[model samples]
Target: MVKQPAPDTTRRSEKSRRAIYDAALALVGEVGYPKTTIEGIAARAGVGKQTIYRWWSSKAEVLMEAFLDLGEQSAREAGQESYAFPDTGDLAADLKAVLRATVDELRDPRFEVPSRALAAEGVVNEQLGRELVAKLLEPSLQLYVDRLRTAQDTGEVRQDIDPRIALELFVSPLAQRWLQHTGPIDHTYTDTLVDYALYGLAPR
Candidate 1:
């Protein structure tokens, strides 16, 4: 068998990978995804295009990984161990806390521009849209799934409720607001979403 790369080589590769991710995010933000090219990413990242191709097959793949890394970084900076919804046993509070953090993230320029470009493209490109939802978005949503499941177990949520669909009640509204410019996104808004989702809209 051929010899594998040394540890130092692997570290260098990781460093290069991060640089490529940063370059891709910046380029997509500045120029939009369709205009972001492998060559441009390579130049901005100071890596060869072959290096990017060695790991990812296309610009879309690169951008997807780039966005994932950005989200993880944001979560870590916010004192979260991972980008998962919290399960503090208080369903409303946990949901509101996470959503408030998300509101801050949505307003972050580094995330907003590139994410907007991808969202715009996804609206018209079904394949890319599904891919983005499946790969970059669904995993995060699953955290809410887990939280909702716990709420169901504790009788906080209705026993017959579908956690997957139920979680979307609060989650999707914020997502739509940010994606489509439908409404404002802030802590108070998200807090109210949590309350409305749990208590219902019919004069509780």
Candidate 2:
């Protein structure tokens, strides 16, 4: 007698969870955070509100998790380790490479649309903003700090410099450009930012 396998409830739950994440990201991107609702996410996801409630407490939690999943998924697709700074012995090359990848991420509609919506909400919702920064933003920044500290140890960077503040020279400018649409962003722009940050404007 041939034996059939039983249904995989774990697989089913994972599918449902992925659908919920997709629905939450799409809804927030399309409608913005202020108008997005748990009910709406459930309807779009083709799942019951109770399904979402079983996993998360509120819309904010679901949306945040969705973004986190999106980042991880993107990282997987790119074959890059999420939140790990690249180390190629040459700090400048490594930073430039990561920044270029960041530019690519920022340019993607799937990321940019929902990201803008979240950024706008985070500006006004203090708790949500803090949580988002703590969960999604700070870890990546910490990677930069760690990398810079390594550079200091190697005599590639000044020991007296604060890695946190020093990172802002390159990171903040690119972020401001992307967030504000103040200028165009591309590989060349990011590469230049890295060079300028490391070498400064003074002629050699």
Candidate 3:
């Protein structure tokens, strides 16, 4: 029978995990995903290969979790929960606030480069793409779903609207802009998106 690691041992392991995440993000940003190896990450992180292998199966898995952790840290620094949505009673206000934060995050170098590497890889790698969408992207999107549902209940959103599709009207546009360099993302742009999506651009 194998005994669990001691508390100090666990703390040290966590420290190593953080170091590995930092190393993975940095290496991916500098070298891109194709050249990023578990061995390279371990060497840069000052840990053994077995340590990383014990925690994660592959470089892709390590980088995926690393990016997720990085996003969560950035969100926390921005005074927002990584997995929760802000509901300020006013739909437009809440969406604009959240999207403004997203714009800031997209511009952050620490978040931007690594995310680009991962997103680029996802576009070409089908399995990793699905895994990333399911594990990392969908969970974040569900927060929007929950918020939109609440807005519908309170009459701030149309009752017949599909929260998933409706939320994407604003969300996916920003994502596309950031991913493809399609346009500038800013507070004003996102604010306008909320207005257009909610009030309709045809006449109202």
Best by lDDT: 2
Q: For candidate 3, what is the lDDT?
A: 0.87
Q: Give the TM-score of candidate 2.
A: 0.93
> Would you estimate the TM-scores of all the predictions?
0.92, 0.93, 0.92
- Candidate 2 local lDDT, 103-160, one digit each (tens): 9999999999999999989989999899889888988899999999999989999889
Write the residue-wise lDDT of candidate 3 on 54-86 in tens digits.
Answer: 778889888888887888898788776776678
Per residue, candidate 1 scores C-alpha lDDT tens digits across 1-204 of 112335557778989989999999999888987899999999999998998777788899889988988988987888877766777899999999888888999999999999999999899999999999998888888888888888889989999889889988888999999988999889999999999999999995
Worst 10 residues of 2 by lDDT: 1-10
Listed per model in order, the count of residue pairs whose N, CA or C atoms clash below 3 Å is 0, 0, 0
In model 1, what is the error at residue 24, expressed in angstroms?
A: 0.4
Distance (Å) between predicted and true CA of 177, model 1?
1.4
Report the lDDT of model 2 for residue 188: 98
lDDT for each candidate structure:
0.88, 0.90, 0.87
RMSD of each candidate? 3.1, 5.8, 2.9
Angstrom error at residue 145, model 1: 1.0
lDDT of 1 at 158: 90
